[model samples]
Target: MNINDFYTTRKNVFDKLQSSNTATKILMSLLMACFTGVMAQVVIPLPWTPVPITAQTFAVLAAGLILGKRYGALSQILYIVIGILFVPWFGEMTGGLDIVLGSTCGYFLGFIIASYFIGSITEKYAGSRKFKRAIAVIGVANFALIYIPGLAGLALWNYLTYGTMLSISSLLFMGLVPFIFGDIVKILGLGAVSKVFLPKE
Candidate 1:
């Protein structure tokens, strides 16, 4: 098929998926949740902190772009709930309710909210076919939304464990600093390719 035909084909498929029944939507969300779990397995261990580098953020951001607001958040929620309630779907092959108390719990919480941010912005801007707009929307929302809670959780965990909160500098170093390079790469890469990824209008 020609380039235009390929895009048309991709759009038709996405439209069908989006317009499917409630049951299909649930299944699609579950699929994205499972994808998040799988991506969580892409771990890069960091000895200094509980938060390791992983591609979960990449997948979560993509979920919002592809699934839109409602289903994107559902996908993240399902991933967290399943990890807390059932399986070891988190990075480093870890999970369960006890994981909720760990240092990275804030990041998990951030993931849900970040999905919403991405989805909401994506719905508004993706159809515009504006390349820079896509980058700005996804990059800003994903980075800010995820890190705000992520750093908060890191600080809180430290406080609960040590009985003293580390300085903001320390939290930034532990939770945000280490991931900056990788996060930017992911954001730029995702934003650049987001048009092909998002459901076409």
Candidate 2:
């Protein structure tokens, strides 16, 4: 083949690969970010904190289940990035690092990491028909990941004195107990919902 022709073919191949990667990134980023935003509106507003709880659990769990580990993480990171870009896609239509500085910042960050961890674990157990088991794992992982970081963030943000039971109790009342049952319901509901959406692989 002529050198020019060979060069042209190689360039075309390279362009195709680049296009494919871009398409994959777009599919993973825009689609998943939109899904997460929609889930935020499906809310159950609480009187405790401005950070209303929502079906974000479903979005987080489904991200990992459908997209797997790396893509799932990318999807969540995209959601956060877009939210920070001032789109107000998060809970209560809130956005920016101001939300991050709020009481639920740790949980906000935890959501992304939890999605990755759950996705990684679920991807491994995605053998034959271990779907329920995988969901259970994801649920527990999501709960702990959100709860621990959330509580810590709240306590630290308030600067609760170590020996002050009132501060400790306030933290529990505000952070942990109110949402415990709701979160459990969320875990079970979202886990099952994810199974329906996830491909049987």
Candidate 3:
């Protein structure tokens, strides 16, 4: 075929692929999973806890913020799927079911639920001119869904009971306090990054 004919042919194929729902879902899921894998690579070890800080939270936030609720949850679920069935995509290492049985499983699973909530809230506020509302939803969702559950898992693993672990002071020091600053920074960064993906609505 001539060069122009070939170009047109390729364009038509690309457009057709992009228009397919399955193609879109697979593409977005892979993109988010890749981001999760990459984010897990940048680990910041901390002395106080086995759960060291990492950019994986950034990936989690972005997955939710950009993908919205259903797709965001699907992306995280896909990450778990790939990690279990294929390669171990968890931070700084790789393993099978043992990874889930380890100390970090709570945080890992929490990312899925958290991403859905964060994405949902962000979707609502996205169309409003009120950046503050967007910021608030983003902040609350990240803190409540991701951090709270994550740290609670750690606390429970440490043998802290539900009532005690859920206490304000207990959550503050064990979960919220140590990570608040870091979470804030991540939230801000993710918010800025989100603007690139979310349309001007």
What is the Å distance of residue 200 in model 3 from its true position?
4.4
What tens-digit string does per-residue lDDT give for candidate 1 at 97-124? 7787789888888888888887787677
Residue 187, candidate 2: how far off, in angstroms?
Answer: 2.4
> In lDDT terms, which candidate is top?
1
Query: What TM-score against the true fold does each predicted structure earn?
Result: 0.93, 0.75, 0.76
Candidate 3 or 2, higher lDDT: 2
Backbone clashes in each candidate structure, one number apiece? 0, 0, 0
Q: So what's the TM-score on candidate 1?
A: 0.93
Candidate 1 off by > 4 Å:
199-201
lDDT of each structure? 0.82, 0.70, 0.69
User: What is the Cα root-mean-square deviation between model 1 and the actual structure?
Assistant: 1.6
Worst 10 residues of 2 by lDDT: 157-166
The 10-residue segment of model 3 with minimum total lDDT is: 126-135
Error of 2 at 121 (Å): 1.0
